[model samples]
Target: MAANKLYIGRKVRDLRQANRATQAQFAERLGISVSYLNQIENNQRPVSAGVLVALAEKFRIDLAELSGGEGDRLVSALSETLTDTLFDGYTPSLQELKLVTQNAPGFAHALIAAHRAYRHNSEQLASINDTLGRSLAAAETTPYEEVRDFFHFVDNYIGDLDMLAEALAAEIGIGDADPGPVLSGYLERHYGVRVARATQNDDLVRAYDPEARLLTLNPYLPAPTRHFQIALQIAQLHAEAVVDSVAAGAGFRTTEAYEICRIGLHNYFAGALLLPYRRFMAAAREVRHDLDLLAARFGASLEQVCHRLSTLQRPGQKGVPIFFARIDRAGNITKRHSATRLQFARFGAACPLWNAHQAFESPGRITRQLAETPDGARYLCLSMQVSRGGRGFRQPQQHYALALGCEVSYAENFIYADDMDLTNASAYDPIGISCRICERTQCASRAVPPLKGRLVIEHNMRRTIPYSIRPAGDAPQS
Candidate 1:
């Protein structure tokens, strides 16, 4: 067996520089010679066990960072991006990507930033073309998508913020039965903010008064939304230090993306505080991952429960690795995060075959589907329809679908998977990221032809699945 290798020289160097210490001075703290420290910092030698301990003891560095947590995330994201057809034949090997991550993380990050810009611009052009009633060009990235990618690159897990929120939740005596009072108490005592429900404009859900120190929530808002708004406000005020610290280093290109990133992180902390990871995971297991039961237990709604389930990615103690997504009636993915290999499309709507889109037809009901991606991975998906803005007769409600799922291998962990025919290949519905990127040739529901493939015009025959595609290279079919 190969021995464990630790290459955290860059991180060590960063810590040393941050403290304004030279090699000799830092080496003295670690009880190492200056030459040895230089060798370690330059990656000529791996960080020794003794140096690792010294880092934690003297510098108070997080051991996890030294374990390549950030590097691993970068490698995963870069690997995913390389899978795009734009780089089809040029995808680098995993070991090569890891080398880039370890040696030049900045360069790796630069490459990702460039790709995001290209992707965003492409998506924007597509949106413009759609609005002008022209043929869809390509999908440009949204600020939401940019922030989503930022979170996705980090595996959607913010370790420091999550831990801090967990500790705060425990300190405030936040119980599962009624967490609202605990959250409200914390806001009142610490920030001098009073939480109350009041009449608001039809479009406005929450309003906060700075001078009066009042948080006014719409009474018509659902119980979950109201509680969530309170928790979100608490995060904005209390978790700003930690949230700002992370955001400062996240490499967001635009101001909008950066602001959205902060809001997303604050919301994440709120969910962590509301659910309180340890207790929620225990309840998840006890109930066999029943969404309804978990929601009731946590005094949350089903959507909140599903979102919380996806964020149970604490290192060493993780719950089911699920993906959560919210899609509007028009098929635009409003929100998404995946812990599994099934990546949502960054450009446009999800695959039409995904059960979440079908959820609109059966509002308020949970729908299940065993889905197989073009890559042959199978998932057990559970989707539910939800709505907002239905306060008055004239106010139109915006409907959406919430989906949660994981790989079929983890199917046994979810109650929704009990009745699924996991062993039957035919049971799984065929799905892909989007029509432009999907390589499926004979899909009946394919909205457009694959962007990188040849479309054969069959003037002689009629077929249920239009546009037979010959992608890149293959023998001509009769």
Candidate 2:
């Protein structure tokens, strides 16, 4: 077994040397005896509380920063390294790795560097995997296939079908008072289907019956969920052309991913048609994007509200180009959509400092954080957790967080920004979008360092922070 390494002494000695002061001079500045300072630097004496306070007060540095509570930086780096395909089948539990990072950064850094090297080697070996002779075709099979085939069966365009649905609902006197029966009636009238109560078997929420040409929804689904399903079914059938047109615009290589995206886009159009963009934008502006109120007014879910927020970019009358993202506890980005220039990692996961993951700890509570990337782009993020299904303790359902944000300058428009002290930038907690897209140099939350830079760790002369680096993909290295 390897022996435990003490980093405190090395860190203390480095800090003292960087000031270019003698041991006696440093001791005098710190108001500690020369012998005591020497003992602390040599690891013979632990940094006492008084000395720690004195250092913080003298240097005007937060204790958290000095003690490296910013250890999340190391975790971010480790996660990026571990995501390498070398650990494709084997992964240390997140809790275990997090503990190591918090208590043993040097070991974590060494392990991460090794893993990254292994991943690079593995990539070289697997280079041929991309060109393997395989059919690589879309089957046009299964539920997703059925959905896509149905869209292709019709041209991909649904003009005013949403309006038609609304008109029919109004004709039938279906207001918000009783949305379920009204929506069910609207679906039956439009699609020749009847909503039937079905058991939650096979984890299916809704299924289409070919014989009756009927859509059967799970009885356990909430009212909002049911409405979304019904609306989605209508759009799938009536708005196929619109969905296909959008999917075609994407120019995807595989039909499978394209089809999935098509369904989602179609659902989005359905929601938009239900609560047209103009009215939705008006409501959002009025409420200052209060997601709960918007959700209620539009009869949409929080996820739906956030998703709609991203789509507000409609040519000339664009609303704020806020980005919306959803992530699980493991920090995997399950869903992400952005209207702004913010680039998200298409191949990897998001940065750990993103508020989307933090919302899980506080659940339902909103958190605000300001993030600056190495490139100096700043963002203000707002996040809160939301849960779906599992109301009666069957599995307690899956709960995760949703984060919405815009550039820092545009943040004040949000209601949550009202009481926030944005004047003191330091008071705002620091965060990052994802390391791959973020270029912030000094961020402790950075994972793989920016894809555009090479970090050079100077062991002989350590700074107050961990490592420094030159921007990657910049001018040729001189």
Candidate 3:
């Protein structure tokens, strides 16, 4: 959103490499000098509009492919990472950060990776102060966090696997009639794997034994979940090589992380297989993103539907960019992904004022909120509680609230946005990423002071909060 000249060096370089073209060859194709092309690829020169048009014409590429989406995402992530107190006095300007993301994205990624390693080390140190050896020796990040970052950076869309799964979906006639029986039949006939639904409560939604060629699914699990699990098993058995290649290319440091990423990719593939991209996107548009209707039609759960919606970042067929997060009752974020500019806090917990937390009290209802972040971006947020496999009283029930949101500009496309006063400023709740980095000084629920602010305490006078935060650069109050 800055006025700086766009420098898409990394993208251009990647494009050239993807086409297996050298600098001279690529320049020749673009009708530009080799030196000029080299400069553009190296970020020494900004990409001209003519070159951009030429690239589009010659390569048959979508002009949107060269847009600032990835750069903006990188800037958001780097900006969040730099918000740490560890980077005090080292925060770069927004323009400077954008330059890094546009030109030297590899370095931007490295900086983020280093910061993650530092945070992981700090957490390890806090948990095991007595065992200094174990804490200091581990320089790598948590496998789960690494995998989460992978999905986050990739915009939650795996093109190859998505296409593969979509083809499978078409082949198996998914999303038509009851998917459970269809998938079960496919597994039995194709893989020679028997699928059995367990009536008794063993607390296992899906248990697959490859050696025995059997999959035992909990009967109590919703039909949608069973169908998804069958799809997942199929993904693992059907496209192990594709998933493995993707995981390998992800550059995970540990085997644990690689295995986790493999499973995550399989799960992603399963979701894609059930709700294939093009058809699902079409359905979402047709239904105005009504989660309940979409779920019923696609034989998926509310959470699955929302999660699939978040991953609609396929090249030209992109859906309205939205952010999705799932949080437990304890306020701990179980899953968070954003295709929008709004990124959730990577710290302790999400902002309490966020409507996602409000869904717990309302259970079956969809809680709608018009929220404005500190950066002044307005979002039409929707939340609802989703139950995940805990039917028996003896079994511990796991419940999490699912949140879906997009910029208010896209509100008309969202079914839950109906009947809301989206134009009224007062209807929108002010929210922040987290307490520690939030610039807001007047939030009643402020639990901690911002890193850049000084606390103003008055023993004689009290306000909503015990102390007022005096942000940096403010003169003595008039």
Query: Which candidate should be chosen as best, given TM-score against the real structure?
Result: 3
| Per-prediction TM-score to the true structure, in the order listed | 0.77, 0.61, 0.89
Give the candidates in order of lDDT, highest first: 3, 1, 2
lDDT of each model, Cα atoms only? Answer: 0.80, 0.64, 0.87
What does the lDDT come to for candidate 2? Answer: 0.64
Write down the lDDT that model 1 would get: 0.80
Q: Write the per-residue lDDT of candidate 2 for residues 1-478, one digit (tens) a residue.
A: 5423332555567677887888898888889999988877766666776777887777565554345312334555576565444444445654555557645666975675466445544555566486456432222223443343233222222334434544544455543445567667767886788878776643568898867978887777777788778877767776677667767765454677687867666676566655566667778899988888887876777887886677664433557667677877777766665544344554367777666678988876788877664434577788899888644555457887898988767776688778767667675555555665464677666666555456677789876557786654345455
**Could you say which candidate leads in lDDT?**
3
Tens digit per residue, CA lDDT, model 3, 327-377: 998988889888777887776788989999899999999999999998888
Model 1 spans > 4 angstroms off: 1-109, 119-142, 474-478
Backbone clash total, candidate 2: 13
Q: Which ten residues in a row have the lowest lDDT in candidate 2?
A: 149-158
CA error at residue 323 for candidate 2, angstroms: 1.0
Which should have the higher lDDT, number 1 or number 3? 3
Cα distance off (Å), candidate 1, residue 7: 15
